[model samples]
Target: MTETSKNLIAEYYALHLGELRAFVAKCTGSPADSEDMVQTIFLRLLQTDKMISAVTLPCLVYSAARNIVADYWRHRKSVERHETYVKSHCDCGTDSGPASVYAPAEIMQLLERGMARLSPKSRRIYTMSVVGGMRVSEISDTLGVAYKSVENRLGAARKEMRRYMSRMLA
Candidate 1:
């Protein structure tokens, strides 16, 4: 920046540092957060070529600090909310958790082989119920079959696949 701009900013810093410190400290409630925020308010002036009016420097600097404080609280609140959700709702157990219950590629390979062994009609019904996310009643209506036939096929398909996955996985 030009020397003129740098000197102008330095003068503003000299005049406003204490007020900015107090304002930010009051806004955030933490001395450490205020220190960073006070520095940020001054540094933001470095990006601008225009000078703050001597008549309005307090309004200008305080407004910038207010915006920074708002953003800090907003980000902190989001992080706190995410941490709370994870603490209450997630079970991400240690290494032995459901997170590692399956090796994904291995499981997929076993599933593909088991599916290959199913009779085509059973496979179609199972695919509709599982992969296509269709209910048994929906599958029955779409395929013009009785709902009981759809349920039996779905049950048998699930039983066979479970047995196949267990035998292969074990």
Candidate 2:
């Protein structure tokens, strides 16, 4: 990378890290995912010579980040749609009526519907991990699965849930 680019990136990170993090978190719906996306954005910038030379470099980064976030949302939406289709095919059905959870009835209903959309195994894994507050090892033992399987399932479940929340809000 050029000295100018290094200086620019440093300046941007020093001055705008919090803002960028907040922006990415708002766009991506989670802090951890936003952190990953921001790292990816900067890495992409570092690798691209053309992008490094733009006069409006900061704006360009933000734009690119936005595009990335949009793409992420698109993929997430696709996953949710697939899950919904699978859910429809499965015996697990959603309740259109009021929910018993803490949120407003409508919001709770939507969350339940979204959770219902997940595969039965995924739903069980998620409930155990989140609601039951079980560790991966504990969940794996309880479910008679490996720790890695629990981790992978939980990761996918979290992504699906975030996507569901994003779609619900949007």
Candidate 3:
């Protein structure tokens, strides 16, 4: 903020830019990413008053750079892992797929039959829980039923649906 602080930070940047860039590049394995990270670290230094007042400027800079690169890698790895999971789980219509056994129309008909077989109360509870995305507690409150009663009804509904679906599929 002050002239002295600005000058000191400017001098530190001039002296350490190359070393910082090299260290970040080695860690990140990408020149462009390393350059960007180095700039981010210096920007952080400018924003953080404690960093500007630190006794060892180079040490602080290198430490901040390392931390930033480490965070970048951590974030990148997390994103890569999530992408892998999404790619594997997404329904892209491969031959070996969850829908391979039953056509969508057949499954829908079976589901309708199964739902029809449930008692009216059970069907309402099941629809509220599954189709309506209502939690058991919310359903209980809305229906003025006990929580355990709602759970029991939902369970019975699921069992009936499972039995009906099994018979239809077979």
TM-scores across all candidates? 0.50, 0.51, 0.51
Residue-level lDDT of model 2, residues 1-170, one tens digit each, is 78898888878877887888899999888998998888878877777777465467788789878988997898799879977864565443454433422246766787788889899988999999777867788899888998998899899989999799767744
Query: Tell me, what's the RMSD of every candidate?
Result: 18.7, 11.7, 14.2
Per-candidate clashes, comma-separated: 0, 0, 0
Please, what are the lDDT tens digits per residue for candidate 1 over residues 1-170? 57766776789888868877887898889888898878877787776566666566567777788888887898789779966864554344655566645667877888889988999989999999878967787899899999999899999999999789767755
Per-residue alpha-carbon lDDT of candidate 3 for residues 91-113, written as tens digits (9 for 90 to 100): 55567676655677877887888
Superior candidate under TM-score, 2 versus 3: 3
Candidate 2 matches the true fold with a TM-score of 0.51
Alpha-carbon shift of residue 102 in model 1 (angstroms): 16
Residue 11's lDDT in candidate 2: 82
For model 3 the local lDDT of residue 127 reads 93
Per-model C-alpha lDDT, please?
0.80, 0.80, 0.81
| Span of ten consecutive residues with least summed lDDT in model 2 | 93-102
RMSD of 3: 14.2
Of the candidates shown, which would achieve the greatest lDDT relative to the real structure?
3
Q: Which residue pairs of candidate 3 clash?
A: none
For candidate 3, the lDDT comes to: 0.81
